[model samples]
Target: MKKCTIIGKTNVGKTLFLINFAGYLGLKFLDISLCDDKKILKKYKLSINQAIYELVNDQTHKTRCLQSIIVDVPMGKGKKKLQLIDTVGLIDGIHSNIEIRKAISHTLTIVRVSDIILHIVDAASAGRDELPSSMGEVDYQLAQFAQLKRGYAILANKMDLPDAKEGLDKIKSEFSGNLIIPISALHKKGFKEVRTFVAHNI
Candidate 1:
């Protein structure tokens, strides 16, 4: 299956996007596979609401491992299966926790091998300064690296929030040559564009 990894800074709504995007694709219950820093994998079954409550969080590094789910995207006459992998949020500098650092390392490894890259940036935070998910060096570097691949696109998340428009504009200016789709993971807005991008790439 094609592996499309969701990567971004902490608290940028990557987990929420993963869960809600699955729901948007018509999944009520999700079979999620989580891989820890030690490379141990575990699977779980949960409803959409349950996964959101248990996995989504405001704090940094809430997703310490790699969590993935398989969903089929409708093509012209058939469906294509792809693995939507939600990764540990990447930070600019070294993390204080060793385990988190290991997780981040694992995330980078996954990024290198994934077939598709959905780089999410917090548009609301990008409009402001000093926020964790604000436009930073790491984002620029990731954009530079991922742009070399065929299946790379930016997801300007949190478009439903106030000031996100300004943020999206700034992101457009910064990422002039890349494809960006504005989306609100919480409200399930702009999912059609995202689906189209995924389907085309896969």
Candidate 2:
């Protein structure tokens, strides 16, 4: 299956996007597979609400491992199934925790092999200054690297925020050549465009 990985800095709504995007695709219960550093895969069945409560968090590095789910995208009369993988958040500098550093390394490795890259950036934070989720060096580097891939796109998240428009404009100016989709993962805005992009690429 095509693997589309959601990557971004910590607390940028990657987990929330993963859960809401699956819900937007008409999934009430999700079959999720979580893979640890040892490559041990564990599967779980959770409702949409349960997944949010368990996975989404405000703290940094809440997700330590790789979590994946298969979703069917509407393709012609039938459907195309692809894997949506949520990775550990990438930080700019080295993390103090050895485990977190390993998780970040794993995230980078998966990006190299994934079929599709959904690079999410916190638009609202980008609009402001000194926020943890603001656009950083890692984001710029990731954009440059991932754009070389066939199915790479930037998702300007948190568009519902007041300052998000400014942030979106900045992202557009910086990533003029690449495909950038403005989305509010919390409110599920601009999801149709994202779905279309993913479907065509996958």
Candidate 3:
């Protein structure tokens, strides 16, 4: 029952990675797929409150069948369970408020409880842009966060682009010895390592 929050700023592939990573962990997740179905959300008028209500109502039934709900298959003969959470919110060195800080501060709380922090980086974005992308700030913050608990792993996503691999040397030097993997989620490359990592860590 280890809880792992896929922590990063908005649009940094946190939600997408959770689904992909769950597949690697042998879980049959039906969450976001249902959320994406326009027919369903449309049938309910696509209101956020209604969606929340439906989710809560549905989970009550699912919770009664907890084992069947959580575990998809016997991985290495029924040895493990993985819990993943994806979050959205923005933060920066520039503008912020107590509310925003409190939300971002929850990341460190998640850090404390996770067995491993899988820090995914948008490799192409950070090296090209002079300004800090979410990856840059996330890297620095999680580095500081890791000083306390949960060893972190870096996944250099979006590696399909030539520009992504172009600055590998620099990124490697910056992260030093932490396991930084070059993987393109779009291409399914580098997932074997990611799969092995999850199994090994938890």
How many pairs of residues collide in model 1? 0
Off by over 4 Å in 1: 36-40
lDDT of 3 at 60: 10
Each model's C-alpha lDDT? Answer: 0.92, 0.91, 0.52
Residue-by-residue lDDT tens digits, candidate 3, 20-86:
5555555443343211101222121222233233432211111110111122323576666665544
Query: Candidate 2: which pairs clash?
Result: none
Scored by lDDT, the top model is 1
Pairs that clash in candidate 1 = none
Tell me how far candidate 2 lies from the true structure as C-alpha RMSD in angstroms. Answer: 1.2
Tens digit of per-residue lDDT, candidate 2, span 26-58: 899999988853474798999999999999988
Give the CA lDDT, 0 to 100, for residue 18 in model 1: 97
lDDT computed for candidate 2: 0.91
The CA lDDT at 18 in model 3 is 56
Candidate 3 is scored at a TM of: 0.68
TM-score per prediction, in order, is: 0.97, 0.96, 0.68
Instruction: Please identify model 2 stretches exceeding 4 Å from their true place.
Output: none
